[model samples]
Target: MTPPAPSDENLLPAPVLVVEDDPLMRQRLALVLDGLGYAREAITFSQSLGEARAYASNNPLAMALVDLGLPDGNGIELIEELRAQDPSLLILVISAWSTEESILGALRAGATGYVLKERDDLEVSLSIRSVLRGGAPIDPFIARRILALLPVAADHIEPEEPPRPVEAGVLSARESEILELVSQGLTNREIAEQLVISRYTAECHIKRIYRKLAVSSRTRAVNEARQRGLLP
Candidate 1:
C-alpha cells in the first residue's frame, strides 16, 4: 500500500523564530504563525536580540520573523549574523522602524522581506505567505520612501526635465478612481468597501493602475499619477 502523503501543514518548515520585544506584538505574531499552519511547538519566540542569537546558535532555523527595535540591540545586526550562519534561511523583518537607513540596512543584511508593524494582520499575513512562496514582499510605503531618496542621493548629477503627462486615456475610469482612493491611504479592504467590490477586485484594479503607471508600489503609483496629471 502507498504511504499517505504529508499534508501542507505537516510539510511546513519547522523551528521558526520570531524576534520581537513588545509583548502584544509577539502575541499577535504567534497567532499569525499559528493560523499559517505552523505548529506551536515548532515556533520559538524571543524578545531581544541576545536571546534570539543564543537560540539561533543552537538550532537550525528554517525561517525567522524579526523586529528592528530589540531590547538588547538593533535587529539589523542579528539579521547579518543569521544570514552568515545560514544563507538559505528565510528572514523577514517585521519592524516599526521605517527610516531609509533601517529599510536599506535590513535588506543589505539579507532580510528576504521588510514589513512595517503598522500594517494590519491581513497585510502581515500576506507578507509572510509571500516569503514562504519565495517572494520578497516590501511595504509600499517603504518602497515609496526609498524611491524619494534616490534623486537627493544623486545631487551631483544634473536633474532631468519633469515627466511628460501621460494621455488621459492611459487609465480606465475605474482604475483612476481606485488610484485616487489609494492616494488617500486606503487599504485594499477599505477600497473594496468604498467601491462596493471584492477585495480581490480592488487589488486587481490597483495592479492595473501599477502597470499603467509603471510603478510597483502604491506611493509610487500615486506620485507617478500626480506627475502625469492623472490626479489633482
Candidate 2:
C-alpha cells in the first residue's frame, strides 16, 4: 500500500542535510527549510562533499538537498554514497546544472527530485515540500527536456505495432482535472488553491491519480498521462 503523505508536523523532527558550495544558495535553502517548519538545529549545512560525507557518517538524515557542482567533487558522487547509506533517504538535486547528462545522472543516482537553481524561491520551496511529501517534483524545464528525449529513445527500439490508447474514462472527471494541474507543475497546495479544495483533499486526488497511473512520482505520472493521451 502507498504510504501516507508527509506533513509539516512529521517533518519537524526529521534531520535534513544541505550540500551546497555557494553561501547565498545555502542560506536560501536554509531559509526555505526553516519556513517549512524544519528547526534551525535540525538542518545541517555542508559547503563541500567531504564535509557532507563527514556529517553523513555520524548522523542519521531523513533528507538531503544537494548541488551538482561542488568545491571538492561532483555532487552526484555524494548522492550515490548517501543513497547507498540510506535507501529511504529523500534526496533532491537543487543545482544550476541543467545539462542532460547531469539531470539524467542525478536521477539514475537515486535523486527523488531535480530542480534548477534558477527557479525562484517559491518554486524551490514547492519542490522541497513535494519531496518531503513522497512526491517526485522535476522542474518544468527539466521535465520538458526529458520529454523531448523520449522520441529519440524510441528510435533505438525494434519496430512493433502501436499500443492502444488509454481510455479517457479510466479516471474520474475530478481526477483528470487534478492530473492536468499536476502536468502544469503545480504543487498540491497550489492545486488546492486553484480548485478551491483543501490541501489534504488535493493530495488524496493526486494519490489516486498515481494509483490509477501505476506511477510513484509526479514526473512519471505526467509522462505516462501524455503517452496514453491523457494530456496534450
Candidate 3:
C-alpha cells in the first residue's frame, strides 16, 4: 500500500541518505523512509563508507541515516566528512551496536540522533521527525548511559582542583545567552526562534561562542562553562 506524502513544509527539501551495508536493512530503512513520506526516488543508499562518501561529495543531503559498521571503513569517518561538508546536515546513527563508546562517538562526531536498529519502525520514524523538529532523538538506553557520563558534584567524592576561571566578559551578553541555550540542548534553529533572532545570526553567535570557549562540541562547551562558573 502506498503512503501519503508528508505535509510538513519544514521537512528537508533534499533527499534522505541511507548508508547501510546490509541489503535487507537498507530495504527496511527505505520502507521506514516511505512511511515518513519520502518518495522512492527521493532516497539515496550506499553500502559502505567509500560509497557513502562518494555520494555525499556530489549531493547535498538534508539528513543521513548511517550504520556504524561499514564494509570499507568506519561510519564515523563518513559522519565527520559529511559534517565538514554541511554543518546543518542532520546525521542519525542507526546501528545494532549499542556500545557507549560508539553512541557517544557518533554524537560527538556531529550526529543529531542515535537509534538502535532493534527499535520499532515507528520509533525510528518518530526519531526522524523529532530531530527534524530540532530535538536530539537518543534511544532510552543510550540516554541513560549519557546521563551517567555527565559529571555531578557528590559530597562523598573528593573534589578535584577547580577549573581555571574564564573571564565572563570574554563573551558579550547575547553570546552568553546563546551559550546558555546551547547548554540546554537547544539547536541553532530552536535558539533563533526562542530569541527572535535570525538562524544565521544564531549560528554566527554559536561559532563565536565555540571559538571563545575553545571547544568543538556542545557537551565540551557546556562542561567548560560549568567548570568556569559561567553557568549555575
Candidate 4:
C-alpha cells in the first residue's frame, strides 16, 4: 500500500510579508518563504515600504521579512509603523548589511528579530522559526560580540571594584563613522546610505568592530567608544 499523504487542511501556515527592493532578491525571498510551507498569501513580496504598508493595511501579517533600504523608505521605519498597528506582530529585519547602529536601532524600535539576506537559506529559515518560538536567535559571531560587551562585573557576589577605569580604546576612522551613526540610532540601511556602502559590507564591518573591541551589545560599544574619544 502507498503511504498516506499529508493533508493541507491539517496544516497551519503562518502569514508572511516580504519587503525588498531588488527584483531578484524579492523573488528569491518568496521562494525561501514558500519552502518553509507558508502560503503565497502568507508570503507577499513588495519592493517598497509604501507597498508593504498598503498590503498590511488590507491583510493581517503574522510575520514580516523587511529589508533596510526600500525604494520608497527605510524598512526599519515600516517596522515601527507595523508594530504600532499590531503590537503582537513579529517583525524581522532582513538586509545585506548589519551595522552596529542598525542592529541596536531596530531592537530599540521594537523588531522581534534580525537576519542577514546574504545567508537566508536553511539557517535563516530556522532562525526565523526560532525567533517566533521565543528564542533570541542571534548569529554566532553576533553572540560573541554581545558577550564581550557584557559588563565584567558578575552578580552581587560582591567582586572587587576596579582600581582604575580601563579605556576600551579609540575606534579607527571607519569604525568611528559606524559608531557615530549608531549614536544617532540609525538603521543599517540608513547608515549604508549615509556612508555609501552595500548593506552586506556594512554588516561585515560591524562584526569586525565587535570582535576588535571585545564588546557585545551596541549600547556597551557606543558607551565605551564615547569614553575612548572615538565618537564626536
Better of 3 and 4 by lDDT: 3
lDDT (CA) for every model shown? 0.81, 0.81, 0.77, 0.66
Candidate 2, residues 15-108, lDDT tens digits: the string is: 6789998999988887777677766766778999999999887555678999999988999999989987656678999999999889988987
> How many clashing pairs per prediction, in order?
0, 0, 0, 9
TM-score of each: 0.62, 0.63, 0.62, 0.56
Candidate 4 C-alpha lDDT tens digits along 170-224: 3456766787788789876788788876443455456445655778878887877
Report residue 138 deviation for candidate 4 (angstroms).
2.0
Model 1: per-residue lDDT, tens digit, 50-91?
899998875557789999998788999999899876666789
Give the lDDT of residue 30 in candidate 1.
82
Residue clash pairs of candidate 1: none
Assess candidate 2 and give its lDDT.
0.81
**C-alpha lDDT of residue 147 in model 4:** 65
| Candidate 1 TM-score over all chains jointly | 0.62
Alpha-carbon runs more than 4 Å astray in model 4: 1-13, 149-232
Question: Whole-model lDDT, candidate 1?
Answer: 0.81
lDDT of 3 by residue, 1-232 (tens): 3334478733644457899999998988888777777667667889988888887774446788999999888888888888776676778899998886798678767788999999887788788778777888999989898777666524334543432343333776787888899988999889989998556456656765676788888898889888888888
Point out where model 3 deviates above 4 Å. Answer: 1-5, 8-12, 152-232
